[model samples]
Target: MTVGPAEARRLSWAQVRARRLAWHGLAEPLKGAGPADVASAMAGTHAQMMSAAELGIALRMDGATRADVREAVWGEHSLIKTFGPRGTVHLLPARELPMWVGALSALPRPSSPHADGVRMAPEQSEQVIAAVGDALRDAELTIDELTEEVVARTGPWAGDLVMPAFQGMWPRWRQSMHEAGIRGLLCFGAGRGRKVTYTSPRRFLPGFAAEEPEAALRGVVRSYLRAYGPSTPQRFAHWLNAPATWASELFASLEAELERVEVEGVDAPQWLAPDASASAFAVPRPRDVAADVPRGVRLLPYFDVYAYRVGNQPPALLYPGRASERVLRGNFQVLLVDGEVAGLWHQRRSGRRIEVTVEPLAPLSRARRSALDDQVARVGEILEARPTLTIGEVTVGGHA
Candidate 1:
């Protein structure tokens, strides 16, 4: 087999898992770091679901409670929730919003020929973006309220651009909200009753200025590699939701900072920080799985960044063999033991009682079963509910 320039090293599956755990801050949870530290380590948490984001951050920090996270976000305002990498909701460190704003604002505006004549003109899009920032500057407003303010500022043309969407007729111009958030001009705010609200990131984090675009984007690339490297440009592109050509070009400019090395099981060259050593991949595996192989157990939450961001691999690899696509679709919400999907677990609360159910992909060893019990106790502690355990056969995509 011809090993090309891309195929520089071979990394065993164990080596891959070892490096992943270390990079993810899981091999050893961080000490004395706050929620922002955890966010910075992973670039950002997958935060479409607020609970998942909170759990993801807590898992990475020692002694961080739900209240601590809430304080950082709503009280101290150290973390900001907004649209981030890949145009998705994420929890980012408030201090870093300027850099994110600069980098994300540099991406080419999205256009869709498939739209039924409802797209915003580039100039109109910019106007809407500015309007969103201005409207939310004084106070948090619900989406409807924000839209009305935008319409009042940008006139009827902005309000008239509605298009069909899965959620039904959405104002085409409002798509710029994602852009506004990425540009550090807007973010999610505390709710009013059941109504979600938006506010300017500067409402709490003041005086942040966007860094020069190219330098800001270069920093983003560096952070991604720091958290998930020994990877290729293709993987970086996939994670960033950018064109492969764009990522490759960026990587080319970063040649002096990255060192290419061969991995045991991979066919392509992987790049890492020049100061990083291959010894990270040679760490001893846990004794339990070290013998029979593939050890370490964790009950990760829905959209945990760990499961969502594996480089180049299908997300299904997290689950066991022959697991149904339905199950794999829900895999991000499942339990993982040894880096592979081991089971499904869910929690429900009633009064002071929280019911947690587990359904393993297959029968587990005594050690793994004990590990599952420990996770159940930990879940109960995090939720502050007296938890009862239920174990059985779980049908994928069904209520736990």
Candidate 2:
């Protein structure tokens, strides 16, 4: 049966609810990869926050000590494997770090200018790795402290070559640490001058290891597909920041575990679990429901993974092309209804009151307007203050 755009656009609330629940409900167990594995699974800062909030995990630091709400879920902080994915440091689960680092290392290096600038020789990379290990032997050092230690050990090489080399070899170093069974759960402790202290390495979670890099990648891919399936290869490639060639190869390698499905009547192809049913495409449920707002408008945080995923796809399911375009400006939060974006909103807090400025992409129907008001009220509850809603002029297509 062909699902037309109109039918897709008219998704029932129940269907939307089911899809949302399915997307965020499952958790992938990391038996051995440690904290690093968890960090690797989270691709960026926004991704990390969303993952943590969804999992009900809290990142906290006291004085000079750092920990999470549930230490048993991961492990103690390991400072050495903190900065990897795109050169940013993240707090990862301890056990799963090794395998995730290994998987990232297995990825082919890019020839892009940025990649070329960051490439390091094998010997130079090894020297920096060893130096870092020595610096953080028993105590955790902040980025600056660790960098200084690397310089002190390697002398002139440390100051000029080692520092630069470390940047290039970070990803590989993470892979090596994972291979050696080191976890990645480094956290921000107290700041000493400009340097920060981190937590020591200790087993945070049990049952994860770094062996079988290929198997680990396959497993991660499987989970991603299951949670965010009915998506195109291009989308997967974008999500991983991987080359198309590599993405296709990875998909081919996992063919036995994945099923290819047509996106209803569209020419687009999606990959899902072999056992996924047709109902998998049902719309998602509302993440939050406000008693005061109308039924249709919902506010979502900026860089919401949902917004990121659907940015380039068919608009029939959500906002029209113009509305989506306005949301892409990346300046404000989003307003969504029935799994589609309807407008943009900006929030300002003053004393006890919160001010909200909204710009709808199109003229709101009476039903949609009522739904929006209810959503605003929910926002008020979250901020612990009443909200003053201000509506902005609508913009259509490229014209305002």
Candidate 3:
């Protein structure tokens, strides 16, 4: 059906939750899938904080653990660490790096924040990215080592580059690090002592060849739609960290493979992939039992892709006056119940035990409260630590 903006199917909040939960592999804990599968399923886990990424992947699986993630990256070579959406570190399946590389590389680089005369120009950034790849071929180096090598190869100007950031001087050349990752030249490696390390993606997948930018980006858009669609071009733009005009242009090219859908109470028309099922838009009836709890209750860490992907939606629909602008803007970890944000959670290691505190936005049923306990138990298993749960009073728009 040709659903124009006016005739779009209004997707109720429950329907939205159901569709997202299913796509997220949270409808049921995924069985027998490795960490690589977890990364691939959600496009990629948010790895800006590596622990959160590990937990994010483990939460979607029946029995995965941090060791599983370590083995995948450090031993099995099934996953590669690289910068992804929003220029943050992410764990991506090694096999899919080329497409990610090509698509991300195609995005226009943001303007340098340094003074006009101090900023490295696009051409200079490219030179540094190439140098980084060359320097790390089959080897791992810390940031200082990589920086020195980049200067040696790219010229003195690379080291001279600096910019003001947060009222402090920032290494301007470090901006190209993201570019290096997108170009399949750089990734995070096991650190040495307390020092961070970098390596080439070739260390994990030798001789990886990238797809042409256009074709690869088409695949990316399709993947995004598969995992998080019934969405808009503007949302896609945000997800990609691309300019809206560019995202709209790219999305328009895929119209033949997309269809418009109503997202219930949302006024704007949302689009989904051509193969999306009609059931995804059905008005969901409230359940008497904890239907979404047994299989989907989760303690998703901060900046989890699921929350970030859906953050732009109307607040009332998910957690009603619970999400603050700062919480949304800063990306906080949350307690997800029945495919919606039910509360916020925090954890700290106190000796061998993980002390967990939860603050819900509203009162939950007895079944839901029990399910939350189960979720805590699952987290304890993953962390290999005894867990202590403290239920805090429901507080709206408070930081965890």
Clashes of each: 11, 40, 6
Ranking by lDDT: 3, 1, 2
In candidate 3 the C-alpha lDDT for residue 395 amounts to: 43
lDDT tens digits, residues 122-185, model 2?
5665666666656555566666566576667655444443213433633323332221222233
Residue pairs that clash (backbone atoms under 3 angstroms), model 3: 9-262, 10-264, 11-262, 11-263, 11-264, 302-333
Off by over 4 Å in 1: 1-10, 165-167, 274-294, 305-308, 312-320, 323-326, 396-400
226-294: candidate 1 lDDT, tens digit per residue: 666667898987776778888899888887776665655466677765322333122222222212334
TM-score for candidate 1, residues paired by index: 0.87
Per lDDT, the best of the predicted structures is 3
Regions of model 2 farther than 4 Å from truth: 1-22, 25-99, 112-119, 157-208, 265-268, 274-296, 305-312, 315-319, 329-331, 351-353, 365-367, 377-388, 393-400
Q: Which residues of candidate 3, in runs, are more than 4 Å off?
A: 1-10, 164-170, 274-296, 305-308, 324-330, 393-400
Q: In model 1, where is the ten-residue run with the lowest total lDDT?
A: 282-291
lDDT of 3: 0.73
lDDT of 3 by residue, 85-186 (tens): 888788888878889998998897666666676767779988888899899997899988888998899887787646655876655578778878878889
Q: Evaluate all candidate structures by whole-model CA lDDT and list the values in order.
A: 0.71, 0.47, 0.73
